[model samples]
Target: MTEQGTVLMTYATARLSDADIEALGSELDRIRADVVASRGERDASYIHTVIKVQRGLEVGGRTLLLGSLLPPLWLAGTAMLSAAKILENMEIGHNVLHGQWDWMRDPEIHSTTWEWDLVTPAAAWKHTHNDLHHTWTNVVGRDRDIGYTIIRMSEDQAWRPWHLAQPAYNLLLAAVFEWGIALFDLELDDVVHGRKSKRELFDQVRAVLGKAIRQAAKDYVLFPLLSGPSAVPTLVANLTANVVRNVWAHTIIFCGHFPDGVEQFTVAEVDGETRGGWYLRQLLGSANIDGSRLLHVLSGNLSHQIEHHLFPDLPSNRYAEIAPQVRALCGRFALPYTTGPLYHQAASAWKRVFRMAFPSHPRPSHPRPSHPRREAAAVAPYAMA
Candidate 1:
């Protein structure tokens, strides 16, 4: 079973009993405890090494771009810059901001201290992503990442005429995902609906603008200008590199969340939820990408989305180490472990984008009752398209 439409509570009811769920949760807790206890120098070294490599790539890429007038240099420089951006945004920035390395007592790498190389401020992202999105996971209305409130990602989401253009715009979103994420972190709908104040919205917008301008000046102005005669080519190379990073980040993220067999939930399903229930939801709701160590590193180890979702603050390097235990736990529980290769997973997520653009009835076997809270939460002020 690659794709599913049922909410998590109903899915769980049909599979595991409450006692079984509790047992599963206990097992998961043990796994987490083991990892937390074993975290040491090896894990610390992995993150530091990644950071060093990323900085080297960025420096080398910019140096090469200074001679971007040469075709080979332009290609090589652009590739290196793209890789560096991906590493910063994914492996280092994302995990560090998740407080993955805070146990090291390294103030420089602390979540509260590190600012990412994106248009969104670290604080804003932590609120929306680390707080809201992670807490809510795949809950239909509560999680804003479901189609990012622009494209239709779940059957529970009401389809609109605008979604007809999702297949096209989703492509644009992937190319400029950093900007899309910056806007998404603003929670514009909350401001419109009075859930968030205009003052708060204004403050966030100001922060975003500040970050955007700095990022623009650094990439579009300062670096390009430093190249003098190669300024135009350097500018283009930087732009190309950013686009490449954005697209790769978008693809890896979508693969982790939207691929086949990944489940979604209604708010009702999660009501009075237990820790085990949350674990089950995370396990069922997330999909994984089957890839190599290099692929995992480039993805910030998010290829093990299930593990990351279950242990968001765990070091990225450990997800691979613990993946087998997680998979085995799933096997023991007879729960589905959804995973696929990059191409297949990416295609599956995109297939959902196109397929869910049009209206369709819910599956007859699991008829969904009205969820007023879920419905209201899903409603936004306006469609982007």
Candidate 2:
């Protein structure tokens, strides 16, 4: 068997009988149903409270920065701003744009209305991230998020000499992750491949530039200028905060998506996928961070990446509640529940980044498993989500 064939055969989903897969899907659906039924004031209050706290931090940070010439105030203000940006980007903006809070019927916090501090427009992010990424997850070719169309992420993806710099640029990418995501979300590669029109790309570019200008003006111009004698220090502080937020967001995201034991899929592997099969793929493809309640909140509950992938629109707060059940389900099914400390997971993900930067030699093959649904040629290799 080929290396690719071996991968398909060993995937946790491939060993399950059709009836077993159906049963797994049914149980997952039950979990979702229960969460949906229980969603109410508690969930609403959780999001509202987070939003208030984030705003207060931002306000306090900016107020302190007006006197940022004082080293102590600069340090305190910058730290608060960094924390505020992280909270907004990870907890509030991300989850809100995922429509996690839409069930509350509050237009003020609806996905359609919320704009993030990042350069990427919410609509563009929703299309690429919510529509394409969440649906496809770690499917190598279809999910542009595999490496954001830049870095080499999977052995299934062909490597280039340019990838040799991924280890270095990967660090730069982390520092400017919001910009990287904004560019990635534009789907420029799709335009090259004729999957997206140049005209569409042009319009998206305009939207990105508009958002970028506003974000730049706020953080760089308006706030700094408002500081008068402390303008330069305040400007430096704002820049530091944004970079800190970017690096932290990148770390949390990479830890969840690329860490050891997180599986990548081929389109062929997912062809004609059933509900249970989808659940299985998500479970295997996503790894979680083992952390406290604060860490969970800061990650927008994406520390529970498996549960988030399984039920993307469910309330973020409910992830912790459902996590034990999901882990138990994986245990019952004899599937891997990939979770570890943040440091370990982050290190594993970074190790993969460096490893994939080099050429990937084929692994020795194993006999193919007798999967009832392994239709390796049923779909085109580059099938879009």
Candidate 3:
């Protein structure tokens, strides 16, 4: 049977007793309280100030070039920097708005109608992200992230065209349109999962198209005319920055579940399992990443993806503190727990993608043996889902 099918079959049969569910709930509650207590001081005020300062600097930098104090090449460079800043605002700041930084306040209230301009609708991050991706991770019929058009997660998705040409196509796609693909997922998921009425789906498509057009006009026409020819260079720079930011986001997200050790499940498997077992699968089938304290702070410590899945509402900052307890719990359950350095985990995920896309391609069959100055490990048994 295919891996996804196998996972579904296993999930269908697995059962958790009431005591197990209660224990899982108790553990989650304890972790939530600890996270809130420890990271409660994350004032959104300071974060807002930083964003404003960055925007002001970008504007002033553009104005300087327009006034002829700075060269055109300098203007172009500055514009690119500004664009990067915008991408950062979307990726990093958006997570903060999700209360990945602070859970005391409702993110929706702060994100949709806050005085502080801290949200990005471009990524459609919340809908495809917080709602779908996290909630239905690795479930082929449900997890929007796994529906790679050119890449298959398991043998079930294997097809002649994909087997023949997907590797090269997927690599280029990942480099250029990872963000675009993620955006596409929002609509595709609704169709695939039958989440929308026919009329609602059509309306959503029209709404998205209109939003895209308006954004393009604002970025390409209005901004250039207002800022002068310098805005052209700025636009290019911004585009490059956006690519970098998205690539980072894609890499970070992929590592959580795409590494060799992680398992992929089908709808049947997940449906068969109890809530506690499903939660355990999410934890065991995911990997953790480790880096500097500041890195964890910036990326929402999503390297600790299992913990995040298990305790979605908890502040990310608390992942480090709960790491030991989580490890102990998994050990007690005899469940596998995987972790590694950031690059190590990322490389593993990337390699897995390559393997899935190009079956004949030869790469390291295992995690890199060489220990870099900083290396991450991926922990998993050699069992298929």
Residues 114-135 of candidate 2 have per-residue lDDT tens digits of 9999999999999988889987
Instruction: Provide the lowest-lDDT 10-residue window in model 1.
Output: 376-385
Cα lDDT, model 2, residue 55: 95
Model with the higher lDDT, candidate 1 or 3 = 1
RMSD of each: 6.7, 4.6, 9.9
Model 3 per-residue lDDT tens digits across residues 1-385: 2233222223322233435544664675676676666664454454454456656755665454343324664555555444435434532454554545444465532444332222224336566767777767777656757735446655445445455556565556555553465356447646766867778666656656666566566545555566575666555544554455455666777777877667666554444344455566677567888788755644556767888777765555566778888888766655567878888988887776666664443222221112122112322211122
- Candidate 2 shows a clash count of 0
The runs of at least 3 residues in candidate 1 whose Cα sits more than 4 Å from the true structure, single-residue gaps closed, are 1-9, 12-14, 363-385
Per-candidate Cα lDDT values, in order, are: 0.88, 0.87, 0.56
Q: After superposition, which runs of candidate 3 have C-alpha atoms over 4 Å from their true positions? A: 1-25, 37-39, 43-125, 189-198, 358-385
Candidate 3: deviation at residue 21, Å?
6.4
TM-score of 3: 0.71
Give the per-residue Cα lDDT of candidate 3 at 50.
46
Q: How accurate is candidate 1 locally (lDDT)?
A: 0.88
Give me the displacement of residue 82 in model 3, in angstroms. 6.7
237-281: candidate 1 lDDT, tens digit per residue: 999999999999999999988998888887777765666777888
Clashes of each: 2, 0, 9
